[model samples]
Target: MVHKGNCHTQAVCAVATHLPARIHVILKEDRAYELRDLEGRPISKKDAKALIQREYTVPEEIRQRTRGHKKRRRRKEGYIRSQIRGLVTALQASRFA
Candidate 1:
């Protein structure tokens, strides 16, 4: 189960039991429980918060987009080929010149 108290205080606790072998494991992991980030580097809470904000925070414009909305059109194969041909011609011209 996931228990979230505040933005900075979130924990995931799992209770596992093996009846046959009589094995029980109680795991309680929290974001702030460890003073290290996913990369295993030591980081302060403020630094962690800043890193999370920089990576996970979404832009307001993207957030306002409707679900299932087509934001961009896919490039056609012909268009891509033409662009590549143009680039190749330009490169050749530059090389010859």
Candidate 2:
């Protein structure tokens, strides 16, 4: 009696090669560049958003709508931020110890 077949064995030790990542710092949001346009003043949020949409492949309408929403929401974003903070603290403690 062959108890372990190809299906069972593959399922038991599935090695994910390229798992999708859930957390990422959007590049534009993460970095700031001196805006020489609009008379050397800081870029308006609206303008900054437009530039981001133009530079990146993101859809325009969605980007505009998402401006008010925080990346760190209490229901979803908050939980992820807490997890990241915990990991960072653990890493720091390990390094010091």
The C-alpha TM-scores of every prediction are 0.33, 0.25
Instruction: Quantify all predictions' global Cα lDDT against the true fold.
Output: 0.53, 0.53
> For model 1, how does the per-residue alpha-carbon lDDT over 5-66 read when each residue is reduced to its tens digit?
22222211122233323222213332233455778898999989987777656544544452
What overall lDDT, based on C-alpha atoms, would model 1 receive against the true structure? 0.53
lDDT of 2 by residue, 1-97 (tens): 0122223345334533222221122343565544434356678677867765565333545544453354535557778888999999999999999
- Which pairs of residues collide in candidate 2? none
Every model's Cα RMSD, please?
Answer: 16.4, 21.8
